[model samples]
Target: MTFLKISKAAVIGAGSWGSVLANVLVKNGLDIKIWTRESKQVTELNEQHTNHHYLPGLKYDERLVATDDLAAAVNGRQVILLVVPTVAIRSVSQKIGKILQTSNERPLIVHASKGLELGTHKRISEIIAEEIPEANRAGIVALSGPSHAEEVARQDITLITAASADVAAAKTVQKMFMNDFFRIYTNQDIIGVELGAAFKNIIALGAGALNGLGYGDDAKAALMTRGLAEISRLGVAMGAKPQTFIGLSGVGDLIVTCTSVHSRNWRAGNQLGQGVPLADVIKNMGMVIEGITTNKAAYELAQQRQIEMPITQAIYQVLYQGCDIKQAIANLMQREGRSE
Candidate 1:
């Protein structure tokens, strides 16, 4: 399929991931503007060429501008990348939808955010579809995998997946973002891709908690392996292809988020295991730990669907119900044994 010609793009959210992705587009020779809620961040990016809060010491290209105006960012851009946190997806998409209401432009809508919506358990794409009308929407694509903003900013080799119901749309994103160090793969199962990206964070929290408790390689390996089983079970129940869980958004993302120091979810779990309160961990981290909220959503989803996700249930209990960390592990260990 022939890809749409994209010369310019708008990236929503000025967080670490948004900044890195906007810079990537600029490096690809596309004019890109980033929308941030903070006016100070706009000045910092436009004048100083840096988002010191997120990507410290990393300079952005001159062509990459930052704006506080939503319309200014979304008005003429051919592509809009929603890089905001999952919690903000609906609000941001509604704002963009209002702007696109008066126009017939169908710009490609690409979302890089993970995590299911609270209360509704809706995916990011579903949230976007709820807010944006079909006429104003060109296509919705999910750009997911293990790629981190910090690593991508330094020109590290990053691999990602672009998933869409429309193959051409996925290919367009793949073409626009691929470089010598950054690679893109296309997948048709948006359900599996998004679920894999979101569910792995829950397991990563468990991994971090185990590490904080000084559990060695055996425990960590068991947690990860069993975590994949539960994640795959839930994803398959929700209409995702089984193979998708083994790909980048699945086991691949699970590994990085579970083991890496850069993972806020893992870090938060580690803090909790080290005797810190959940509230204190979130407050001290100074960043969004997606796993906390995602844990609630995933646990509820599993319950509603009658799926067995012991790790998710334990994590949720620890976070919301004030279950003791050590006791939680004991409960998990005491569960009935089953074949792998």
Candidate 2:
């Protein structure tokens, strides 16, 4: 299947990643529009060329524009990128489906969000397919990897994965966003790609909790190594390719998120380790800590599948139960030793 050139695209959220993606399109000479629910951001992005609240101190492209009206942002676009938080994806997708159902164009739908739906345990691709009618979509794609919006905004060299059951759709997206500073690889294991991307946050938060508790680098290293093991176990149980965890979407994303200063999940966990209440840590963050919610979902999933996920279980106790981070770490440390 071939098509007309992907000239104009719509990025359906104006948060940090969304804004950076919109600017990437502009950098690649595509006409782009970013939709935000906040009216103030429209002026800030369109007039001032900035997004101070979500992505401070970064000057966006003047050619890139923003709007509060979702319909105006998406109509007639060749590619519609969903960059909203995991919780907000369903509602936004439902709205997009209604507006575009009768339209003539079947635009490529890509999601950059990383997290499973809490109750359904669904990936982003599944959620989009449920809300957006297949007739109105070219194909569903999951764009993920070790990409931090903070670094991407600086035009730092980044490599990422674009995965879809539809190989053509993945290739289309790879070309759409590839540039000198950013590159893309295509994958067919959508399940492994999405799961690895989402599950790494659990490990990152664990790393931060260790840091906040004044633990040495040795402890963090153990957590990351063991973290990948459990994440791969659960992913395989759920039909994902095991090797996908060793690839960019898995270990690569895990390292960056667990170690990067820009990781909000790690920061939130650090605050928790420093004795801040979970509610207070989340409020102070002023950003969606995907791992906080993902912990609940992954823990429940592990139980359902009877998967051994000690790290996820420990983090879940800290976030959901009243278990102290120290106690959680202690519990993890006392687990039965197994050969690697």
Candidate 3:
């Protein structure tokens, strides 16, 4: 079957990632529309070409339009990028589904959000499939990577993955965002890519906790390595291609999330380790710390699947069950020795 070419694109959710993605599309010469829940942000983007609330000091291209109306944003679009937080994806998709049902044009959907739904434990793509019909699911894709919005907005060189069961859809998205500084690779392992993207944030939190405790590179490195192992194990069990974990969406993303100062999850974990309450940390964060929610979801998934993910379990305890960070670290360190 021939795939549709994507020229006009709409980005749902005008958060940092959504704005950066819309900017990149506009750079590639596509007419881009950004949808936001906040009417004030829409006004700012329309008037100033700046998303002052989330990504300050960055000017968007004049070709980019921002709107609070979902139908206005999605109508006549060939591609839609979902960048809302995982928790909000369901409600947002439901809205999009209603809007899309009214339009004759069927746009390819791509999700850039990274996290598993907490109670349902659904991947963003899975949630999309459930909300949108089979016809729409055929056009679904996921783009993930080690990219941080701050760096991507600055047009720094970044690598990312575009994964879909539909090759044409993947290629369409790959071409939509591919630029000199932003390179995208295509992969068929959607589950692996999604899992890697979701789980890396949890490990980043662990790394940040170690940093807060004044631990050196040795400890952080160990946590990162073991964290990847745990993620890979679960991914493998879930039928993900093993090699995908070694690629940009996996190890590369894991490194960046765990080490980058711009990581909200890392920052939240650092505050937690510094003796701040989770509520206080999240309150001060003023942004979605996906790792905190993902930790809970991953822990539940591991238990359901009978997968041994000690780090995820530890993070779950610390974040939810009132487990102390020091005790969590000691528990991880004292796990029974095994051959690597």
Candidate 4:
């Protein structure tokens, strides 16, 4: 199929991932507008051309502009990328929906955020669809995988996936963002892709906790591998294809998020394992650690699905039940043996 033409684009959320994707589009010669709730970010992007807080010391292209004008930034754009946190998806999409209500143009809506919504346990795409009018969107897409905004800011070679049931919509994003340093593969498994991306963060926290506890490489490896199994089990139960868990959005993302220093989720987990209060860990990080919230959501999801997720349960205990970290580890190690 011929890919959709995307000349004008608006990226909602001037966050690290949002900024990186906006910069990539600008490099590809697309006119892009980045929207942030903060007026300071607008000045920094327009005058300084940098988001120092998120991508420290990394300069952005002059062509990329940040705005607090949500209506102006979103109206008449061919593409609107939602890169906000999962929690903000609904509100942001509602704002976009209001702006889209005034126009007939249907922009291809895409999201780079990972994690399931807290109360509803909805996927980011599902939340977007709920708020945005169907007639105002060409199609919705989820862009996720192993790519981190910090690494992408430095032009690191990053591989990620763009998923949509609408093949043309996915291809449009793949063409718009794919470049030498960043490559995007197209996938039709939105369920698997979103789940893999969300579930991995939960595991990364566990992996980081192990690291913080001074566990050796063997322990981390065991956590990651077994964590993948737990993720796949619940993913399958949730109607995701089993194989998608082994693909770029699954094991690939798990490896990067669990081990990479740039992972806020991992860092947050590390702090938690070091005996820092969860609130303090979040406050000190100065960024959203998706896994922290995702852990709660995943724990609830596992129960709803009646799936066996000992790792998730253990981690949940440590975070919510005030279970000691050492006890959590000991409990995990003492579980009944099962076939691999």
Candidate 5:
């Protein structure tokens, strides 16, 4: 299938990752527009060239612009990037779908959000396909990996995966975003890529919780290793290539999110480990902790599939079931030895 040659793109969210992606597109010479709900944010981006709330102290490209109007954002764009939090994907896609119905264009749809839908257990691509009409969407791509917006904003060397069932669409995105500082690799396993991206957060939370509980690097390493194994198990069960977990979206992302200071999920887990209430931890975190909700969804998915994800189960119990962190860790450690 011949894909649309992307020139102008719309990034539908002005949060940290969305703003960073908009910058990447601008550097790639695409006419980029970022849509946000706040008029104040648009004013800040247009006049000051910064989004202080999300990406503080980082100056954005003057060529990159922001708008509150959804129609204005999507009207003639060749690619539409969905970068909102997981909870907002359906509502944003529904609004975009209605506006695109009248336009004579089909734009490549890429989502950078990482989390499954809570109730439906659907990936972001599935949610977008459900909300947007087939005629309006060129293809749904999952852009993921160990990319942190904080580092990307600094033009750090970041490698990411652009995965889609439609290889052409993934290639189109790879061409649009690749650069010296930012690299894009294409993968066909959208299921594995998306699942790896989502499920790794659960492990990151566990890592952070371990740190908060005064455990050293050895404990974090063990948790991340076991976490990846369970991640691969669940991904393979759901029709994802097992090796995808060992790639950028899986082990790579797990490493970054678990270790980086910029990881909100890690910070949240640390607070939980320190005995702070989940509500307080989330409240103090000015960002969306995708792991919290992803933990719930993954726990349910594991139960439904009968997958053995002990780390995910332990994290879920601590977060949702009011289980003590020490007891949870003890229970995990005391489990019968099994084959590696």
Candidate 6:
């Protein structure tokens, strides 16, 4: 199918990922607007092409406008990228939906956030569907992979998948953001893409905990491999395509998240492993460490789906149940031998 042309794009969050994505969109010759809730941030972005609060070191394009007004951001746009935290996605989508419902033009919605809703256990796309009706939801897509906001903001070479049931919408987003530095591949399995993106953070925390305990590369490798297994098992059980777990959003993302210092989830787990309290860790991080909530959510989902996810369970106990980090590592090590 011929892709719909995406000339103007609105990013519905001014966080690191949103800013980076907006920059990429602008680089691809699309007019971009970055929406933030804070009026001061809008003013700051307008004056200085940098988002000091979330992404301090990077300077955004002068052409990218930042605004606090959601309606103005989404109105008359060809694409809307949702980059807010998982918990805030529903509220953001609801407001966007109301605005789009009143507008004459409806932009294709693309989600960049990567976490399942805690209470509803719905993916970001699912929440968008619930908030926006079927007709509006038809244009929804999810963009995810191993790409980090830090690297993407720096215009580093990165690849990601834009998945949607609607191939036309997926291709629209692919064409909207694909550039020399940023490559986008289209996939139809939105469920697998979203699940792989969300669940990898949980395993990354486990990998960080191993590193915190001064475990060697062998231990880290084992945790990472087993973690992928658990992720694949749960993802397949949850109706995701089995091969997606091995793709960019799955093992590829998990490796980057677990190994990179840029990963807030890994950093949080590292702190926890180093004997820091969860409250202290969070206070120090000063950002959304997705793994904390994802760990709990994954644990719940595993129970509901009857999937065995030992790494997630271990991290959940350490974070929420006050289980000792050392003991958690020990418990994971003591599990019975099984086939790889």
Candidate lDDT scores, in order, read 0.92, 0.92, 0.90, 0.91, 0.93, 0.87
Stronger candidate by TM-score (2 vs 6): 2
Residue-level error in angstroms, candidate 2, position 311: 0.6
Model 5: per-residue lDDT, tens digit, 1-340? 5686778999999999999999989988999999999999999999999999988899999999899999999999988999999999999999999989978678889999999999999999999999999998889899999988999999899999999999999999999999999999999999999999999899989988888989999999999999999989988999999889889999999999999878988998899889999999989997899999999999999999999999999999988999999999999999999899
Candidate number that wins on TM-score, 1 or 3:
1
Better of 5 and 6 by lDDT: 5
- lDDT per residue for candidate 3 within 77-117, as digits (tens), equals 88889999999999988888877776755778899999999
Instruction: Give the runs in model 5 whose Cα sits over 4 Å from its true position.
Output: none
Minimum summed lDDT over a 10-residue window in model 3 is located at 131-140
Candidate 2's residue-wise lDDT over 100-176, tens digit each? 98566589999999999989999989999999998899998999999989999998999999999889889988999
Candidate 1 Cα outliers beyond 4 Å, as residue runs: none
lDDT of 1 by residue, 1-340 (tens): 4556789999999999989999999999998989998999999999999989887899989889999999999988889999999998999999899899876677889999989999999999999999999889889999999988899999999898999999999999999999999999999999999999999999999999999999988998999999999989999999999999999999999999999888998998898889988889989988888888998999998999999999999998999999999999999999999887
Estimate candidate 1's alpha-carbon lDDT, on a 0 to 1 scale: 0.92
4 against 6, candidate with superior TM-score: 4
On a 0 to 100 scale, what is the lDDT of residue 200 in model 3? 96
Over 214-326, each residue of candidate 4 has an lDDT whose tens digit, in order, gives 99899999999999999999998888999899999999999999998889989988988888998899899998888878889999998998999999999999888999999
Assess every candidate by TM-score: 0.98, 0.98, 0.98, 0.98, 0.98, 0.97
Backbone clashes under 3 angstroms, per model: 0, 0, 0, 0, 0, 0
Return the lDDT, model 3, position 331. Answer: 93
Predicted structure 1, TM vs. truth: 0.98
Residue 49 in model 3: lDDT: 91
